[model samples]
Target: MMAVALVLSAVPLGAETLILGTTQVPRHFNGAIQSGIATMMPTAQIFASPLRYEDDWTPRPYLAQSWEVAEDQLSVTLHLTPDATFHDGMPITSADVAFSIRTIRDNHPFASMLAPVTSVSTPDPLTAIIHLAHPHPALLLAMSPALMPILPEHIYGGPDLADNPANLKPVGSGPFRFVEYRQGDHYRLERNPDFFLPDAPRLDGLIVKIFSDPMTMLLSLESGEIDMILLVSGVHDIQRLQAIPGMQVSDAGHEAIGPLNWIAFNMGKPPFDDVRVRQAIGFGIDKRYILDQMMAGLARDALGPIAPGSPFADAGIEPYTYDPVRAADLLDAAGYPVGADGLRFTARMDFIPGVPEQGRNVAEYMKSQLAPLGIALELRSAPDFPTWAQRIATHDFDITQDNVFNWGDPVIGVHRTYLSSNIREGVIWSNTQRYSDAEVDDLLARAATEPDPEERAALYARFQHIVVEEAPILFINELPLYTAARAEVTGLPQSIWGAISPYLTLDREP
Candidate 1:
């Protein structure tokens, strides 16, 4: 295997370093356990997947040189690039690929993402064949960098995988190598000279600094202490940040299907179990007002769980309009008549962390709107993400507000939010709503294995129709994703997967 040599300018006294800021610090570097963008941003640099998504959202080769699907649509064969090597200078082979697939299938939180995959076999050092229980049309798309990162078998193949100490210092065959991680401070990575890609990563090193607040992080950008913010900044701060000289704000570098923030009811609990009560709550809150006031009119009102832009979205279904009078009638019909206390019932809403201010504002707005209908809505906020995740997963909350990303495709994105099999206890963000329907399950299953793209889309459309009619979760609006950076920074590629790739592609000139 040929190795690429580090090409540093001899005239430069030191290597060029790029520093970025983020509000959330990664709990660990392992992608199989964590799904947050905070974890993906840093881990993207340290690990390489067999396949990657292009700017246009098409699957392309990375570690794997090429792939072919069988005519029966039940298996796929992958050919590895001969030049790929791990950070430790070991050749990356088909065995490592097989190990990573089995590990992710057995241990990953969203293992259902690979539910169709049955087994992996390697006939030689450069080839990997994957067998599937059924035809999965979206298998290639599901193998994007974030979902299927290739791990060094020597380090992660032992027992107690999650508890392994090497998780904090991951070793992979990506363009960059992990250096050190200072908790709550920053994480660092250096360029990999042995990377298969020839002279590709342009930057010498990368540093991601952690900030607790958005304002301080924006200030760091202005003072040149940081080059960019990995995650999108709030819309309220975008204008102010743009007004600063030499700064640019863009909403372009995000995944194709953005996240949808909505109100979810625990169907396993009371009051919410009634369809009329769920519909009453949906009509009580004004989605238009929330989109205008809370979201700064930067988002479009969601018609359903799927984004309107996606082919699978059911455009014929209309969204529930703001109607308190109708909401009150529905509540009364559901047998919760307004009592002498001027209230039908009381409930609390737990706010997820990512958008605290917007969440609280929307909660207060809903409280005021629901008051006229004789429904008391209380607002509750968790101290951190873990607390909030635990509450929602275990069905501990009455009603809650959270966001779900469709991750480019509904098969890989919105399926977990509604699939009954995904309702695992204590598992964060997997069908926490506890919704189950025989018809809906049938449609989802058919869509997963349908080889024809048009037929698959039709099946998803039917699924959306049922979900919207059932009203298990109230669809609010599509959240806009963005990334802010200084003008001097160049060569940053636009991404539909939430993070820029080819870490070496970025450069900041003083």
Candidate 2:
């Protein structure tokens, strides 16, 4: 049975309860400070944003009732709802919106996202005008439910932003309130009766059950124990869940969070520092095979950082086709020759620890594929996600497998990983490869502020061509992420942000 402790006393009789399942563990409970599915999925419900998104990528009013862009495109004026109040009964005002925007810029991993914002001027308690240093075409996208969760300044104004007490015990103006969290088990949330939006959050409460084993979670879903499972990546299980009688599985929700899984090189290292070596490695591996066989034809081959689904993606860019002979020749030209021991060189390969489909299985496949190129591989194992993240952030591995996202726009997700200016130490997702190209940086900079869409796209195409040649990352298959839910679960989020949206209309059949 779904946990009813939170729903029983708080809601009226016959109110429905929502139960979700996930294997991923969050680093913390703040979406404004953290990225990725683990934290964003849950925190997005607990903390609301100025706007929510629809499946067509249309911006819908949420906490902020209406907003208008300045005629010069240098500022965005937000008119917040006067009735919106945090869970603690504190009125959410324009000041909180200003504070939240500034906080996200300073602490969030997407370094270039809010960097253009000069300041936020609060003309009134209901109006906040965001002043920008330049025209930011993707600024509104930065305020999406998942990307920007408005935090209460009065609660999170203390010294340590990351270590704030309110992160665990959050006080927000969202449809839900953080009730409790028991590690390695479940997270419970209660509906906020005083929510700003009327007739919102049809469900009385929510229970997110944490499972170490996804198979068990699937079985639970089959038995009607779990109402839904967010970001389900198990290939066979996805098919299995789809075939079940009373279950629904679809990847429609993740258009904004464009996920791609590929191999990342530490450019600070010797062998990977050479473009030929990286290119050789790319040529050695069969991307088509990974997409067709390993991924069960669920994913499409990714050529560059921009998602294939994005309007900005350049299909004209050259791709590294499977050619082992060419790969060996390049390796030979790079001064590595097969020794009497039958190996030309040795390298250590690591991967993100969770999800066997994307982790150990792919790493082992890479090891086997590279073995034919006279490369002896040592597959390094991480005990958990945090350990692997630390290794990547510190640039401790020679080569590793990684999964990244476009996050609705290139400015929010793509620029952070490729820009030299964002090569911040200890930041996991920001330029860990130490890649620095003035041309690439300049192209990205120009694209971020360019007013004309055509000019912006042209600049991105140029960036893609240069970066693909540099080969800091060997492009692989785009991840096909899905959300599995029981048929009874209605009003499932259909937005580009997917499971991370503020589900105000979530309901269940009696």
Candidate 3:
């Protein structure tokens, strides 16, 4: 195993192919506008970002060779790799960088992510200067692989931004090139010979093998048919898989990709528009039960919107304790008395599609939990991710089970959920709750540009207190899993992006 230049060895191209098992089926290859692991897993390999975030939240160069922030902190200058080119062999320039930023500003679901950016100016072929209206502390972070993937202006600079045919056949300037996606079976990506980095992306190819069932996917890993499986959704099977020999199971490198499983409400509606009703329902769910019984010792209680271990998570917020009597009393106070048949009301519940791990199981558990307490729920299942996303985007459903990420910074991930300005129609993962408060709005706006860490944290602390009390979304236990990989796999991505990153150094030994 003689290394040539750190990431590269003299192994033959076909010697090392990484087969990844997943239950996730990606809707598209473009991650510029799309969020989450489904699209992100492929996008990070096919397309490269200006920078990638290390596990410690530090920024390192990816496509951009170097970057510098101005003294006033209102702008960032990116010096891209001179020889970087898309899969089609077109040189990557500042124009592409500029276009990508503009596209992201207008179309990205996190509408508030680039709210401070006024314009991007390209002075030279390799230099891009991003000018901000305010001091954006998360500018570099917003350019991370999952957050932003620099799209080639030549290929995608056409009529429709989000609805182009080129989306399916992506041409990117990363370490890998898109080969083919055979709908139900698998999506494959081959190594890019013309990659910017010298002797990088040690793998010959990467294949995402899709499974209709979690059991089948796990079986592939057990039989050595697949090299690894990520986002292992079946919580009950984690312990069983961890005991298998030649397999490594752990939840490391996911610190910044904070996923919280919880109930989100449609505040645009009647009973849910009432805060008392919302709080009553929040008081009904037992976060402890979800962790102890459901999560298989894989999760912690995510009491607030912010994930635990984050520097900004407030430990002092008064938790909504489990009190069915109080819930009943609150329902009575809110003018919804239990009927003669002992049912207060029923609302439709939808869960994100993929598998039962996300919202389906949680919705079923909540239905049982809330039924005895006089509230009835109608569980609605989305056949796929797109359908589930569409329902949330269109503001349909009384409440839904969802898994959302806090991608590194409060400005990048947390702001869009609470900011009133981000309540855009037909945008999944935006302010879909339809909640708006002038004070919460003010705090988020200030925190977005506030450079001082203590000041931004204080602002977020207040934001958490207000949202938790109002109960637009009830915090539940974190979505937990043990991603299993073969012991032969080395250089697995240790960044915050984890399994979804480019995995440039990933290699398998014979």
The lDDT leader among the candidates is 2
TM-score of each: 0.91, 0.91, 0.88
Candidate 2 all-Cα RMSD: 2.8
- With candidate 2 superimposed using the best TM-score fit, by how many Å does residue 94's alpha carbon deviate from the native? 1.2
Off by over 4 Å in 2: 2-14, 26-28, 160-164
lDDT of 2 by residue, 218-238 (tens): 888888777888887778888
lDDT of 3: 0.83
The per-prediction CA RMSD against the true structure, in angstroms, equals 4.8, 2.8, 4.9
lDDT of 3 by residue, 1-510 (tens): 112112222222366888788877888888887876888889889999999866666788888989998989889999998988899999999999999999889887776678789999999999999999989987887888777889999889977868887688898888989988877677888899998888889998987778877887777788777788886646767887888987888777776677778889999998999999999998897766777777766887786878875778899988888899999889999999989999999899998876575567788888999998888899988788898899999998789988888877878778778888889799888889999999999998888888888999999899999999999999887777456888999877766768777778888877
| Candidate 1 Cα lDDT to native | 0.79
Residue 337's C-alpha lDDT in candidate 1? 99
Residue pairs with backbone atoms closer than 3 Å in model 1 (clashes): 201-504, 202-504, 255-496
Q: Rank order by lDDT, top first?
A: 2, 3, 1
The CA lDDT of each predicted structure is 0.79, 0.85, 0.83
